[model samples]
Target: MSSIHPLSMASPYIRIAHDFHTEENMRIGPTRIVDHALHYFKEGDGVYTVGNRPTTIKAGSLFLIRPGVPFSFSASPGTRFHMYNLHFDLIEQEDSAAITFPYPKQGEPQRVPLPCCLPDEQEMPVSGLPSSVPLVETATYEQLFFRILQRFGQPNTIALLQSKSAMLELLALLLRQTENQHASSTSDGTYETHLSHAVAFIQSRLHEPISLDDIAKAAQMSKSYLLKCFRNIYRLSPIKFVMKQRIERAKCELLYTSKPIKTIAGETGFDSIHSFYHTFQREVGTSPGAYRALAHSTALQQEEPE
Candidate 1:
């Protein structure tokens, strides 16, 4: 993990929020998630599942699941952890109707919502973990996440954008690392021009509304295939990637300009300010004004000690 590197140090989407782990406490606890769940886990071993089937989570791990997929597991005894529970409200949008707010010539296949999809019986099995944790050394994967979360104490466009970009990069790095771990072998390949083009297209239009289809088309791939590949590479859905970019750019106006929040929302490809506010709050953990004030005060304090 230490040798892992990224081509883009400046990704516009998918970023960290906050990351912290217990330094002293070495014990673990059990948790029950509601219908839908999104969370992060680090520095422990655990098994999670929708019900019966389980997947092992190790150090430097993050998990996000919808209603049907339930994660249930416990970490190794004496293992430390830094974790988060993330719940996304707009994840249920139907796939058939593409979100038409931004990004040109984009379309998505209809998605069927399985409200009652649960794990069937007969998949449960308890496994005794190793007496000690594995030699699972990891890099500073959570540093950007910690920074993003810490930014909630200060409000401003620069910090917000920085956090958003860092989050995107961190998520991509995570997917790459996880995939690499699961591979039986490795393939050495160069980058694709089309993938680069698609990324360029997204970055070029960061301030504009862009759709998943638009990105896929730019990459010369179908919606489903592009989404699969993109997630493999970026650890985020296309729409989500676009939204992260928009929100990142919006932070620019939020910090430097005096424009109304509604205007900022509109300019950033949001349907309305209320929608923007909700999304912003979800990502940053604070209201826009509150963030701005926090950032301003922090800047003042840094410049002139109180």
Candidate 2:
């Protein structure tokens, strides 16, 4: 299995460099990268070989290439590949380490810090991720990439900070997606196969309206059976899973974009601004505008020179 590093809890300095490329018959590396990379293919097809594992790459595929992983890729003949790529380093301070928080009472909230790095036994299943994983082309994902491109175009201290925050959000999204994929693949028997299909369907149509019947049909199962399988694997009904995905996309937009709340609502498939407001408040415990403001303020403060 490939090694994996967890994101740091402290204010790890993240540096981002990115580009968009369109080309035919291009070949790159059997080399190792010094920093982590996230590559999004917007068009065409290719092959990415990591170590001895070769994974097919196509449009809408996202590849997470880790540092020190030997990988290489080339576009198929007569086809042009359009791709967006990001290279970033999560630089933790030498003195930074794992931290813990304790509550005095049982009823009070506990706010333990996440580990700065994962132990070997706790590393995520990197074999499940391979070199390329397909992702839904949600509005929020596209917006994040575009915004990263925009920030790179106009370099500044604040833009650099915003770009890092956006990159971190993208990494977090990929991690969640990878975990879900791993879970579905590792389940038993036809349960695994059916759940994988259902997950792919939901991810591919995250921005569009998806009914339980549609998901059931996609998985080639009856609605009731699909519900049971989905709940057993995910502990949530298909509809609720869809809502959770929409909320996640909304949070990304809230953090990264300056788009109006109504526009973000429409893009994320909320029926109305009121519904978006209420859902955001219920799920996040804050309004969308306030959340964005706080995120921006915190990012700027952290990125400020010490």
Best by lDDT: 2
User: For candidate 1, which ten residues in a row score worst on lDDT?
Assistant: 124-133
Q: Runs in model 2 with CA error above 4 Å?
A: 1-25, 34-36, 42-44, 66-68, 76-129, 133-183, 186-190, 297-306
True lDDT of residue 110, candidate 2? 31
lDDT of each: 0.51, 0.66
> Model 2, 1-306: lDDT tens per residue?
934354534233343445457667888878765445667777779888877778888767777676556788889997778877765545543422221121123464432332133221124454234456546434446667755655553435776676667766765565555565565564455766777688778877776789998999999999998887767656789998888778877877777668898998988778899999998899889998898888677656654555
User: What TM-score, computed on C-alpha atoms, does each candidate reach?
Assistant: 0.40, 0.63
How far off is residue 57 in model 1, in Å?
A: 42
Stretches of model 1 off by over 4 angstroms after superposition: 1-191
